[model samples]
Target: MIDFSANMASLMLPDGRSVRGPICCEDDIRRVIGQVADAYGFRGFLVLAVPDTGCNSLEANAIMTTYPVEFLKGYDSAGLINGSPVIQRLRRSTIPFTYDAHQLARRRADGKGDAAICVFEQAGMPRGIYLPVHDAGGHRAAIAFGGDRPVVSNDEMQELNLWAGILFSKLVEVRERDRRGSGSLSRREVECLRWAAAGKTTSEMARILALSEYTVNHYLNRATRKLDSVNRVQTVAKAMRAGLIN
Candidate 1:
């Protein structure tokens, strides 16, 4: 869990609105949605993390407004994500869109819509806007704000898009940091990899560190195993990508 209370204590919007909160833990994601919903005058919202490759499988990480647990379970069990019209439209477009629940239900009535539409309808989310987010790494995600009445304005939708993108990116960063810490790479192994990344050979690293060549090789091999890399080049690449080594 991350304590983002301090950072979110005073968030000022360009439209002269202020939002303060103590957003902490995975559960706090719902809090964020609620806050945004209140600010935008919406009844509910959902933040979904969909991988660029497979939109059908949503990441374990997500935030949603109040909905029955069984509703979500049934949707997932039915694999409704694969047939979601919103996701299908998002895949084809680069801009945000608005969708009406009643329209979706009518379209799906003929068996042309996804089963997920029923889940949303049951939850009382009949109207909403979809914001597509693209990160620097090319990962795609989306945020949806749902309400019985249309409360989100064009400007509010733009702001919500920015806020959701930042929040999702921060979540990814926190997860990555946790993963690296759990890897438990040793100080010596990281040090050796750092030097190796700096173009230092095993012999050169050994001399510079006042260690035997065999010891340096041992550290390199250990790091390689820890990173699950088949060779030194791959080890260096993996370590660098993980920010374990420069």
Candidate 2:
């Protein structure tokens, strides 16, 4: 578990009325969500992520929060609750997409396979607002709320998107800079690093990437040396912290 003592709640308030937020850290992600949930007396908050590649064997390092463990568990196991239409668009596009009664009402009466509509229709979700967030690499991630159903008017949505883009974009930019900063590792080296972070062995990585074990080892070794890691696991951890891996 991460430490939350640093008072880590420093998220840019998606709340329009007030501009106040506490300091945040990795651990505070949950605490902050709890605070938000209490503010509106909502059911829960869900955080989902899209990986750089592949659909299976993913790391659901995401957090899905809702009242009652049963509800959260059901929603989580159902899979793709995180990848609704609203979220898919948010990741690919440079805008924050909103899902609520107003937006959903505009869709065809037949529902025609709109992702957000489908997700909202799911059994466990609380009927409310959903926001899809994008990171610096253009990968999509999202947060869904189950509660009072906050509405984002056109003007509010525009304003939120503008600052959200800036806030998240900068966070991603810093992470990417850290990723690319390994004194400038080659793309191939970075790829190796990413696979390693996912707990792939060197031999496995070589087989997956179609590269020789020697080349793969060389890349990892060099990267390790560049990163000044004491060992392979340490190297991987450093790479992840530096955003060299997902």
Q: Where is the poorest 10-residue window by lDDT in model 2?
A: 1-10
Question: For residue 222, what is the lDDT in candidate 1?
Answer: 62
Residues 12-46, candidate 1: write the lDDT tens digits: 56545665555443335445656766677666666
In terms of lDDT, the poorest run of 10 residues in model 1 is 1-10
Query: What is the overall TM-score of model 2 with all chains considered together?
Result: 0.41
TM-score of each: 0.56, 0.41
Name the regions of candidate 2 deviating beyond 4 angstroms: 1-24, 29-42, 51-72, 79-84, 87-92, 100-124, 155-246
